[model samples]
Structures are given as structure tokens and as C-alpha cells.
Target: MTKIVVDPITRIEGHLRIEAEVAGGRVTDAWSSSTMFRGIETILKGRDPRDAWYVTQRFCGVCTTVHSIASIRAVENALKIAIPSNAELIRNIIIGIQNVQDHVIHFYHLHALDWVDITSGLTADPAKTAALAASISDWPLNSPTYFKEVQDKVKAFVAKGRLGPFANAYWGHPAYKLPPEANLMATAHYLEALEWQKDVIKIHAILGSKNPHPQTFLVGGMAIPIDPDSQNALNADKLAEIKRLLTKAGEFVEKVYIPDLLAVASFYKEWAGIGGGVGNFLSFGEFPQQGGGQPWLPAGVVLNRDLGKALPVDHRKVTEYVDHSWYEYSGGAGKGLHPWEGESEGKYSGPKPPFQHLDTSGKYSWVKAPRYEDQPMEVGPLARLLVAYAAGHKPVQDAVNGVLGKLSVGPEALFSTLGRTAARGIDCLLIAREMPKWNDQLMDNIGKGDYAIHNGEKWDPDRWPAEASGYGMHEAPRGALGHWIRIRDQKILNYQAVVPSTWNASPRDAKGVRGPYEAALIGTPLADPGKPLEILRIIHSFDPCLACAVHLLDARGNETLKVAVR
Candidate 1:
């Protein structure tokens, strides 16, 4: 057996290292580690509960708005405060836009290259590529001349040897299965997606006052002042602009993104059985009804691939185990503790850098093993799709069925890496379709002269009880995300966030049950252990964001570890 390590996995948000034991051309065992320690939960101690959202939003630049939403929801849950109708509608629109924008970025910018071979695009016939693009969807940019121009641009960049974002990739790797024409088409959409994302963020700027990390969230509701007459606030013109942007984004998802995903999946049908880890799935329901009723994305757990029985997720049953993690639990090293009583103490006792393999018997990752009902549950788009489909959500069911029909694959195929990628595209369409409904609802509420955006009754700290605890959760673009908070005297007593990456990228637990990332790697066939593009494909499908999972920095901001991969 030989050990293969890909440390500081590229094209991702932060540091993540995957070490796998390969024997007979297949991965036998794997360890997923977040190589740095981020003490966001530790920093939140004794801070004002209302300020938690702002601080936690810094957890990750890409997921800024998600952490903020969860933090405010946690505080509101503790106070038993219900937001006004307009606030709910506004928050939904903001989050929906975030979902659409983030998914597009993930596909075109981050994960597309894993399947597309850029160098092969040079050999593609532009006319054939245009035909392929037109067959997928009636996206108007499919002219042969347009594709020829895109090919020339790529050729020029290669000639200059300045690939920029396209540099250092495992180009022409055997794992990339798309034809040259398909690759060229995907490459064109990738450039188009870059322009599309810019317009999408304008919607965020109009509503949330900023794009990356919006400051619109308040503990009880949103902070956007509503005024039809004033041009400064969320006025009529601003609403119209948002609607127009939503319509544009919806067209991109339905026409370009979803079709491209299906076209790619058709070539890699064998992937439908690979990387299906920890059949149990979890989703903390999100996007509540107009008045805080049933969530649009149903919250539940599907265990052992039994789709017929979707069980409700009880946050109380969630616990984190630090057996193979860097943190130490007060109760013991391998003991599982609820988040409200969670601890984030750093203690790195693993083999140092330049090491051959991880001491799987010892601590390996910065991410603690989070288990729901003592089982490692998979989270993210696949989990949300499964939970919603099992619950008979009409829109979700229809969207999923439409894709499955196009791919000509049964629902069982939804368990693999390709399915996970497809689920994100399908969910993006669902959220984009709902955006207009939410905008219309907000407008109707304003027309009725009900324009309240916040409830200041709980803003004062003195109004809080001596002690309270609550869980704030959202079906973030990456999957089930929850923030557990315990407050006392209006200050945060304890805080813990079990983010999506924490659930998917975690290591083994006390019972020696492998986490999703680890389990998915086993039995995977690697064509070349040295290049290991297959490993990246499966892992990137989870959209690992270790910045949200772990962090570390010295006082002088110097580098921490010096490592070598063999």
C-alpha cells in the first residue's frame, strides 16, 4: 500500500489536506483533515448576543451571509421573537440571491475544471461546439462566430503562458471525461458565468447594502428601511432592479447551468455509483413560509438510503466528537458533547510535517466529528434534495424528476458525486423560481402600509432572562448549517457552529465510524496516485470550505507548518 497526500487542496476557500492509503489501484482508507485551527466559537464567548452575527459572518468570505443569518436566527430563537412579514420576505430574497450566486460560482469557477479539460478546448471545432450548445438550450450566444472568438481568446491566453485562474491544473488528466467540443462549450459558459455573477451581486447590494458580507440582518428582523417614495431605501426602483436581475439569473441557471451539468453528467455516467458516502443525510429546513410556517426546504434526516421514511431532525440529538480532531473535550478526548456545551481548545499531537502518513489512531484534523443520533450524516445539496424529495415537496420533486428524466437515470443514481453536483443546479433553479414570489410578497406587504423591517422590543439586553439557549439553522447552499448558542445576561455564554463542511469533511469518531469524506474515498479507483485528480473530483463535489471549519494564525502572522507531500 502507498499513501497519497494532497495538502492545502487548491481551488477551495481554505486549507484542507486529504491523505489516503491506496492498494491495488483503489483507495483503501482515507483521513480528511482541516490543517488549521479557527477559534471563532472561542472568540464569541462573553460577547453581546446581538453582535454574534457580525462576528460569525467573518467565518468565511464566501459564506458570509449564511453565518449571519444563522447567528441572528439563534438569538431570535432564544428570545422567542418572530420577525415581521416584510422582514421575512426580505431575508428570503437576500438568502435566495446568495444561494443562486454562490451555486453559479461554485460550478463554473471552482468545480468545472475538475471535469473539463481546458487544453482540449484548443482542438475543438467552434462550429460543432455551437451546435452542441444550441442542442442543450436555446441560449442565444451559441453562434459559431461567438464560439470561434472564445476559442481565440483561450488560445491567446495559452500562447502568452498566462493562464491565471486556469494555471496549475491537472489538464488532460484521465479523470476529465468531457469531449473537446463539450469542454469548449463549458469553458465559454464559465466566462459567461463570471459576467453573470457580477449582476447577481447587484441584487445583494440593492437589498442588503453590500455584496459579500451584507449588514442587513438584525436579531429580530432585517435592517433595510422600506420607503416607496425615498430613492435611498428599498424603493420601487430598487425592487424593480432586483426583479430584473433575478429574471436574468433564472435564465442563466435554467438555460446554461443546468443544461451544462446534464451534458457533463451524460459523459460520466459511471460516476453515478462512486463517492456515495454515509447514506444518512441531514437538512436543517430553510426559507420559511411568508409568516414563518413550514420551510420551503423541508428539514429532516434520511437514514440508510431509506427514502420512504424521512425523519425530522432534532437538533438536541446532534453532538460533536473530537476523537481524531485537534480539540480536547472537557469530559474526555473521545466523548461526544452537545454544541451548547462544546469546547474549542487546540492541542496538536499528530505526526509533524514531511511525515509519510497520518496517525489515524491519534488526532488528525481540526474538524470534530459531528454525529446526528450517533451517526455521521452527510449534508449539503444532495442531502437537501433527498430530504425534500422524500417529503414530496412538489417543486423539489418536479425539479428533480425533470433532471432525472433528462439524464435518463433513476433516483438511486442521485447518491454519487455527479448527483451532488446536479442537485446544486436543481436547487438553484428552485430558489431562483421562488425569488419573484418573495419580491411580490414584499411589495404587497408594503402596499398594505405594513413596512416594518425590525422589532426593537428585544434589542435591549436588559429585557433578556437570566439564562437561555437556542439553535439557529439554515439550509445553506452547502447543506445543513446550525449555530447553537447559550446566552446569559444578554451575553453569549457558549457558542458552537456545526457548518456543512464540518459535517462532510470530518474525520472518524470514537466508534471508529468514518466521516463522509473519508468513507467516500474508500474503494475509489485512482488512475494515477501521483496526480490523483479523482480524489479532488469527489472531494470538490462536497465543496469543502475549511475556512468555515477551522482557522489558525500566530501573533506575528507568520506561517505555522512547513510540510512536504510525497
Candidate 2:
């Protein structure tokens, strides 16, 4: 048996390294390592509590809204305040827009490459690709030349001396088995998705400003008020365009993306059984409203492995163990605590000869192992699907059912790798369709003289309860995201964050239980270790945002990549 490693897996948002114990034809053990650590939590120390909203959002450009929401919620929880109904609605719309853009990008550009070989498919008959695409969807612009245009653009990009985005790609690798026609169609959509993604991002900027880190979200309410005189009138024409585009995107998912996914998945049905995890899932829930009442969606963790059914996720039950990390904190493996009170006092320094192993049991990722109720659990689309499935959401249930049926898998198969991936596309479609309704509602509220901003004087830290701490959790596009903060003497003394990827890609815990990504990688048959399309397929299925995972910097404070293949 020999172990093959793909460290610092490229093309995704963050840094990750995958190691698989390959014996004969399959992987018996796998480890997903998240290297690098950005002291974002540490950055928040001594700053105004209200500033947490803006500062934390910088953690991820991709899912800044979720970070903003969670940060604001943390301060709100500390101050014991509730936002107005209109504020909740606007926040929902902001989050929803990012979700739409993220889903579209993941489907076309990131994950699609793993399943469909673009270079191979680019050579196929554009006419056939266009015809097939047109037959599957009602978009009026599908044409052979349209596909050819996409190929031209891709070739242009490569020719322009900038294939940075397509780095490490094996353009014509034989294992990338896909018809040229199929690749052409997918390539066209990939280019289209890049454009569509920017359109959706505009919603964030108009409301927040900037792409990754939005500016409008504040602790009490939206920083940007919606009155006509506040800045400008709510442009009905622009809002309508956004709504129309979102609807069109949803339609495309149903008619184009879903069908394409099904057809391609048919050619790679073996993936259906590979990358199975520990059958555990977790979601902190997202889209918050006033009080504890339901927002557009609900929050909770599905500890099905323990309860045999999804249960209410308790934020207080989540803990982080740094035993495997390069930190000096010492305690038992399972300790449920918030980030604010987290202990980050260091015990060891760089190249600390005592700890260099990549295994969590000894040496591994800089990311701390995050556990719910003393156990590792999966997150992201699959977890959300199971939660939504258990919650009995009609649209989610129906859409997932359709995907499973197409794959010829039973409903119970939702726990597997293939189910997680397909479920995400369906989730995106459902959420995209839901966003416009929210936008309409928010606009209506504005028409009624409602503005979400809460302009009261900032709360006094002295007025806060003595020694208060809590966990603020929200769902990001990647999956469940949370931060725990503890405040004493009116300044943050401790801060810790258990990002979505920590749950999905963490190493083994003290109990020897595999993390979600680790467990998912087990038993995956490798047709060709040299061409790791299957590995990338499962990894991208999680839509990892490594910016939210770990970061490393050199003396100049610039992040550098470390390549170590085992």
C-alpha cells in the first residue's frame, strides 16, 4: 500500500491538502488538512463591540453577509437587543443573493470541471452542444456559435498569459471522460455563470458595498437606511431587474443545471457510493429574525447519528480542541465553549520539533477540531438537506427526491457523497426562487416608511451584564458558521470561531472519530491517482471557503503556499 497526497489543493477559496491511503484500488483512510490561520478573532480584541459586525465580515469575501450577520448577532446577544422586522427581511435578502451567486459559481466553474473535462469537450461539435442545451432549456440565445464564443474566450484567457484561475488543471487527461459536445455546453455555461455571478453580487454592493465584505450590516439594524432621501430612492427598475435575473437563474438551475448534472452523473454513477462519511451532519441554521422566531429558514444541528433524527443544535454544545494544532491550550478533547472565551495562549513556537506529524492524533492542521456534543459531524449542503428534510420543507424535500430518483438511489442515500452534491444545486434553486419574494416584502416595508437602521446611542459596556458570553451562529453559503465571544470589563477577552470547514474538514478528534471530510474520503476508489477528478469532485461538492479556514504569513505578512505531498 502506498499513500498519495494532494496538498494545497488549488482553485478553491481557501487552503487545503488531501491525503489518501491508497491500497490496491481504493482509499482506506483519508485526511483533509486545513493549513494557515488568520487571527481574525484576535484582531477584534479591544475594539468596540458594535464594530464586530464589520470586522468579522472580512473573514471571507465569498460569504461576508453570513459573517456580518453572525457578528451583529454576537453583539446583539451581548447587548440583549432585537432588530426590527424590516431589518430581518433586508438581511435575508442580502444573504440570499450571495447564496444565489455562490451556487451558480460553484455549479458552473468550480465543481463542473471535476465532472466534465472542458478541453476534451471544447473540441466537440458546438452545434450539437448548442442544440442539446436549447432542447433542455427555454433560453432563446442558445446557438452553436454561442458555444464557440465561449471556447474562444477560454482560449483567449489561456493565450493572454493568465491561466492563474485554471492552474494545475490536466487539460486533456484521459480520465476526464466526457463528450466534446457536453464539455462545450458546460464551458458555455461556466463563462455565462461568471457574468451572472457579478450581477448577483451587485445586490450585495447596492445594499452593502464591495463584493466579499459588505458594509451595510450593523449591530442594531442596517447601516444604510432605505428612505428615499437617505441616499436615493429605491429604484423600482433596478430592483425589478434583480428579481427578474434571480428568477431566470432559478429557471436555469431547474432546466439547464439540474438536467446537466443528472446526465453527467449518470456517466459517473460510481461516485454515488464513494466518499461516504460518518453519517453525521450539523447546521447552526441561518437567516435570523427578531426574538427566536423563525426567519426565512430555521437553525439547528442534525446529530442523527446520536438521536436517529435531526435535533435542535445547541450552540453551547459546540467545542474546539487544539490538541492537534500548534497552540499551547490544554484540556480534555471535548470542551463546549464560545470563541470570546477561547484560550489561545501559545505553548510551542515554529518548527517546534516535538509536533510535526500531519495526523491530528499527533500533528495535523492548524484548524482546531470543532465538535458538537463531543463528536465530529458533517456540514454544508448535505447537512442542510438532512435538516431541511427532517424539518419537512416541501420544496427541499421534493427537489431532493427528484435528484435521488434521477440517480436511481433511495431516499436514505441522501447521507452519501453524491446526495450531498446534488442536494446543493436543488438547495440553490429553492433559495434563489425564494429571494425575490423577500425583496418584494422588504420594498413594501420601505414604502410604508420603514427603515431598518437603529440609530440609538451605542450601548454602554458598563451597562452590560457582568461576565456574559454566548455563541452566535449562522449559515454561510458553505455551511453552518459560528463564533463564540466572551466579554468582561467592557472589552473582549476571548474570541474563537468554528467555521463551516472546520466541521467538514477537521481531523480525528480525541475519540479517534474521523472528521466529516476525512470520513467522506474513505473507500473512494481511485481510477487514476494521477488525475484526481473524483477527489476534486467530492471536495468542491462542499464548496469550501478556505479563506474562512486557515491562513499563513511570512515575515513580510504575505501569505505563502506550502506544498507537502505525503
Candidate 3:
């Protein structure tokens, strides 16, 4: 048996290292480590409560909105204030837009490379790819010359400056086996989808004033209002355009994205059965409504350890355990208590602990294992889709059932690694189909001139004196995200973030329980130990944002360490 390691898996976000012991053509044991940390929680101390939302969003450029919403909800929980109905609806629309747009970009550009070979494009007959696409999906005609023109455009973009991310890629890796024509078509759509998703974000900037990090929403209500009679009101024309953009996104999903998924699935059918991780799943629910109404998404857990039955998630039951990390501060090996009571002091001063002294039972990573009822669970698109389906969402049910029928697996597969990737694409298509209808509902509310607003009007100032605890939770693009905070005298006293990756990419717990990622990597088959793209295909399928979990060791014959983005 040989231990294979792929550290700093390139071309995606953050630092990730996968070490798997392979023998007899199967991964026997695996450790997935996210080796960095940015003290965003430490930075939040003593800042204005309102500014927490703005600042926390910068924690990740990829899903900044998710962080922003979680921060705002934390503050709202602390203040005990509810946002207005219109504000809630608008926030949902923006969140849905980000979710859909991110999924498109992920499927076409980032994750697709795992399945489609870019080097294959060199041998592809552009005419043949066009013909294939036309025959499969009845796609709008693209002649041979049109494909050539598109190729030249991509080449020009690559030449002008940075190829952005696709630069210096190992495109010619011999193991990449897709046919050239399929690769060409996939690459073409990848470039096209980039522009299409960017346009979707334009709608966000029009309403929220930014793209990567939007700024319209606050705790109690939106900072920007869409009054019918205000000077810069959201006019009918702008509303119509929003509707049009959403409709176009839905059309793209129905016509292009779904076909692309089906087409790509045909070539990579083996993936359907590979990388089946721990089937435990979780979602915190999302998209608020009026009058203490329910959110569009619901919170729940599907535990494969419990035979795939949907389990209710109690916020109070969640806790983090830091037994396997490098930290040995307070709470050495116990349940992950609330962030408001978290300890951040580092106890170690060594580059790497003596292997014999390594705390296998406690302190392995900076990320905490958030156990819902003391169990390792998965959270992401697949979790959300399953929760929504179990909660009786017809669209989610239909789409997921259809995909499962195609894959010919029982519903249990929805909890696996491949299911996470497949569910994300299908959910994106579903969200795209639903957003225009949501926009129309918002427009009708506006047409009725319901411009009422709230700005923390009802909270008692004296009761806000200081020293309070609260929890913030939201469904991010990847999955369930939450922040638990404590405030004293208008300053943050304590803070902890339970991000999506913490749940999905966590290490073991106090009792030596395997994390979702570790268990998922167990059975993955690696064709080449040096270039384990198969392992990456499973890892990146979760879209990990581990800028927070990485750290570096340096030496001048003395131990010095640093933590930063890779």
C-alpha cells in the first residue's frame, strides 16, 4: 500500500490536501485537510454591529452574499428584529439569482474540466461538434465557420491578458479521455456560460449595488428602497428587464444547461457510482417571507447512518469539536459550544508536532466539526435538494426523481459525492425556473404600493444595553452556513462561524468519528497517484471554500508558522 498526497489542489478556491492510503485499487484511508485560516471572527471584535455584514462578506469572494446574509441574520437575531415583507422578498430574489448564476459557472467552467478534456479540443473537428450538439439537443444552428469564429474569440481572450484561471493548465494530461468533439462543444459552452452568468449578476448590481458582495440588505430592512413614488423608484421598465433577464436564465437552463448535463453524463456514467461519501446531509433553510411565514427552503437532515431517513435539525443541538486540529486552547476535546463562548488562543508554537505527540483525539484543524446531535453530516446542494424534496417541493421532487431514474439508483445515492455535483446542476435549473415567478410576485406587491419599511424601529434601546447572544443561519451557494455571536456594550465579544465546508469537509470528532470528506474519500479509485484528478473531481464537487482552514510551516532550524490564502 502507498500513501498518495495531492496538496494545494490548483485552479479552484483555497488550500486543500488529500492524503489517501491506496491498496488493492481502492482508497483504504483518507485525510482531507484544509490548511489555512483567516481570523475574520477575531477581526469582527469592537466593530459596529451593522458593519459586520459588510465586512464578513469579504471573507470569501466566491460566495460573499452568503457570508453577508449570515452576518446580517446574526445581528438581526441579536437585535430580535424582523425585516419587512418587501425586503425579505427582494433578498430572496437576489439570493436565488446568486445561487443560479454560481451553479452555471461551476458546472460549465470549474467542475466541468474534471470530466471534459481541454487538450481534446485541438483534435476536434469544430463542424463535427456542432453537428453532434444539433443532433442531441436541437440547439440553434452553429455552422462550422461560426464554431471557428468562437474558437478564435476564446483564443483572443486568452492572448489579450491572463487566461484568467485556465492558464498553465495541465490540459494535455493523458488520462483525460473524452472525445475531442465533445470537449470542444463543452469548452465553447463554458466560455459562453461565463458571459451569461455575468449578465445575471448585472441584475444584482442594479438592485443591490455590487456583484461579488452586494450591499442593499441590512438587518431590519433594505438600505435601498423600491418605492413607487420615490425619485429613483424601480420603474416598470426596470421591473420588466428583471423579469426578462430571469426568463432568459430559465431558458438557458432548460435548453442548454440540462442538455449539457445529460450529454456530459452520457460520457461519464461511471461517476454516477463512484465517490459515494457519508450519506448524512443538512440544510438551514433559506428565503424569508412575510408575517413570520416560512422560508422557501426548510431545515432538515438526511442521515445515511440512520438509513436515509430525514431527521429534524435543532439549532441548539449543533456544536463544534476541535479535537483533531492544531489548536489546543480552551475546551480541549469537547462538544463545539456556541461561538459566543469560543476560545481563539493558540497553544502550540511548533512547525509540526512530534508525530507521537500529535493529538489524534483532539486538535487536527482550525475548522470545528459542527455535529447536529453529535453526528457528522453533509451539507450542500444535494442536501438542500433532498430536504426540499422531503419537505414536499414538487419541482425539486420531479427534477431529482428524474435524475435518479436516469442514473438508475435508489434515492440513497442523492447523499453521495457524485450526487452532490449532479444535484447542484439540477437545483440550479430548478431555481432558474422559479425565480422569474418570484420576481413577478414581488412586482405585484410593488404594484400594490406596499412600500412599508423597517429600520430596527421596535427594539427597546434599554434592552439593547449589551451582553447578548444569538445565532445566524442561511443557505449559501454551497450549503448551510451560520454564525453564532455574542455582543457586549455595542462591541462583539465573541464570534464563531459554522460554514458549509466545516460541515462537509470536517475532520473527525471527539469519539474518532470520520468526517464527511474523509469518509467520502475512502472508496475513490485513483488511476494515477501523482495526478489524482479523480480524487479532485470528488472534492471539488463540493465546491470547498477553505481559505480559512490552511496554515503553513516554515523553519530556520526553529519552528515558525503562518496562515494565509494559498
Q: Specify the highest-lDDT model's number.
A: 1
Model 2 scores worst on lDDT over the 10 consecutive residues at 346-355
Error of 3 at 355 (Å): 13
lDDT tens string, model 3, 5-49? Answer: 776676566776666789876788877666565467777888777
Runs of candidate 1 with Cα error greater than 4 angstroms are 555-566
TM-score of 1: 0.97
CA deviation > 4 Å runs, candidate 2: 152-164, 229-238, 289-292, 304-308, 330-340, 345-361, 455-462, 552-566
- Give the C-alpha lDDT of model 2: 0.71
| Tens digits of lDDT, candidate 1, 1-566 | 99889987888888989999999999999999887887889899999999999999999988999999999999999998888888888889989999999899999999999999989988999999999999989999998999999999999999998889999889978788888999999999999999999988798788788978897888999888999999878887888888899999999999999889999999988888899899999999989887556888899999999888689989999999998897777787668999998898788877777887778788888899999999999999889989999988889889899999988999998999888899999989999999999999888888889889898887887888999999899988999999999998878899999999999998999999999999988889998898999899899999988999986654234677889999
User: Where in model 3 is the C-alpha error above 4 Å?
Assistant: 151-164, 167-177, 229-231, 305-309, 347-363, 459-466, 548-566
Question: Each model's TM-score, in the order given?
Answer: 0.97, 0.90, 0.90
Model 3 global lDDT (CA atoms, 0 to 1): 0.74
Error of 1 at 76 (Å): 0.4
Model 3 alpha-carbon miss at residue 260, Å: 1.0
Candidate 2 local lDDT, residue 558: 54
Q: Pick the candidate with the highest TM-score.
A: 1
Sequence-dependent TM-score of model 3: 0.90
In order, the Cα lDDT scores of the candidates are 0.90, 0.71, 0.74
lDDT accuracy of residue 353 in candidate 3: 33
